[model samples]
Target: MKRLARALFASVFLSVMLAALLSLAPVLSKHGSGSLPVFRVEQPMHLTEGTLVDFLSRQSMNMRLHHVEWERNSLTLDLSTTRLTNERYREMYLLIQRTLTQTDNVESVRLTVYDASPATPAPLMTVRATRGDLRKSPAVQQESERSYQQYLERFFEVKRY
Candidate 1:
């Protein structure tokens, strides 16, 4: 009889612990930098969320667009990526810039990238470009790849968190 009572007590204790942990999940998730919750808001422009998602996914199988914060004339895109390379970021930026419409409400684009593989997550890097700067930067068709890359290197700032 005593053995059975002890077994029941142990199970009950474990159940209570599990319930407490489950309740704290949301609190923990909110504090974590690695995993982010996507907010659902009305998209600002015709540029479309699906287009950006598709473009980024096509660029790398490991990267994903976590969220987008749309402003009147600028867009802040949060991307979770395991692939970390300057060339890769530039290539993706070029692809993204090419897709933006000149007449749209979005004049500037900022990519706030987080390290997907980090255990204690912080922002990995940020890449931003304005439409006017894009026009003044090296032309894709007319200029050599080196010139375009140099332009990207000069204008696109990278800061590690």
Candidate 2:
């Protein structure tokens, strides 16, 4: 009876340990082997236009400008962040579009994601959608996601230190 109980306990312990490790695999794998810090987005939808400028200011210390303006009838949200990864950039971009487009009199939205890193040469990604485009938002998002995957496939490398 004692041996059976010990075996059961060991199996349960091993299973729990394996589960814990599996859960951490995604988080560990995403952050480049734990060498670099990761910024976890906490409730990105709560970000307001007022907070948008200030939040980005603190988030992108080296960024020269974070601006939002009216262009024609559409609202343009332009922000440059050196610290945010391409994946995070897409997320925040989509989040901002959803948040702003749903509020008040926004007819169309344009989000420009800029890589403001001094090391990086000039390159920017833009996503534009009108109220009509909301129906196709999922398709737009999928294209962006596919682009990110292709980017990772081309550039992602595993390094051991």
Each model's TM-score?
0.53, 0.39
Candidate 2: residue 131 Cα off by (Å): 1.2
Clash pairs of candidate 2? none
Query: Cα RMSD (Å) between model 2 and the true structure?
Result: 14.3
lDDT of 1 at 92: 51
For candidate 2, write residues 86-161 as lDDT tens digits. Answer: 5654454444445445344556666565677767534365555566545443544456546543432232221111
Count of residue pairs whose backbone atoms collide, per candidate: 0, 0
Residue-wise C-alpha lDDT for candidate 1, range 1-161, written one tens digit per residue? 99999999999999999999999998987788675557745343454554555544544433576787766656777777776665655555664475354226567878777878878657877777777767676555654555444556565554557
lDDT against true structure, model 2: 0.54
Model 1 residue 73 CA deviation (Å) reads 2.1
